[model samples]
Target: MSEITPDLVRHLGVLARIQLSDEEVQSLTGQLDAIVDNIAKVSEVATPEVVATSHPIPLENVFRPDVVQQQLTREQVLRNAPDQADGRFRVTAILGEEQ
Candidate 1:
């Protein structure tokens, strides 16, 4: 397994635009080394015959029947609006002219 050196960590930090202290770089080097080692082990076990799966359990499409349902009347839909005009909800103007 390859070791993650401080130089590698510093390079990664530079690429990611992350400012890291000397101690932080050293600490992250060790952590990243362990993670790489674990990934190497996982990669070794993956075989050509084994199919890759996104989800562990089998999945089935669950769909509801498309049936038209009753809808609220215009008055019922607009009942809770604080302001309304011309059978629709009224909203305040969004833009103003430059002074």
Candidate 2:
């Protein structure tokens, strides 16, 4: 088991340019050691055949049938636009070009 020492934590703090008090160093030493131990346990149980994944359950693509139905008319959609051209919504040209 890897043990974290106060000296190591203090060195890390210096390297990170963080200021830590004696009490904070003592607290972090134990917390870091616990985290390392838990990671070690997980590594032990992991195997070559077991693929590493971020989620516990298998993920699948969920899709719905693609069907077309009656949608809003051109006039109905143009009503919400701040500016409208002959039959389409009008907006300022983005690429420094005139339509």
Candidate 3:
């Protein structure tokens, strides 16, 4: 079993942008060590014949039948906009460049 020390915890905290006190570092070291040990045991069981799968169950793509639908007219579409002018939806200037 790998030993997780204060130095390791402090290094991890710095990498993750976290600040930990001496007591917190000690506590986290034990917890992290146990987690690493468990992971190591799991890795040991994995074999060459067993393919790694992200999900436990196999999945298939589900597709719906394609169908044509009526779309809104330009006037109707513009009606929903907060600002409209000259038969079109007028939007505020996005870029700072002058027109």
Q: lDDT of all the models against the reference?
A: 0.92, 0.92, 0.90
Query: Can you write out model 2's per-residue Cα lDDT over 1-99, one digit (the tens) per residue?
Result: 686999999999998889999999999999999999999999998999888899899899999999999999999999889999899888887895443
**What's model 2's overall lDDT?**
0.92
Give one digit per residue, the lDDT tens place, for model 1 in 26-81: 89998999999999997888889888887999999999999999989999999999
Q: How high a TM-score does candidate 1 get?
A: 0.56
Error of 1 at 5 (Å): 0.6
TM-scores, all models, native as reference: 0.56, 0.56, 0.56
Model 2, residue pairs in steric clash: none
lDDT of 3 at 96: 84
List ranges where model 2 is wrong by over 4 Å: 58-99
lDDT of 3 by residue, 1-99 (tens): 787888999999998889999999999999999999999998998989888988999999999999989998888898789999998878888898543
Candidate 1 or 3, higher lDDT?
1
RMSD per model, one decimal: 8.5, 10.4, 7.9
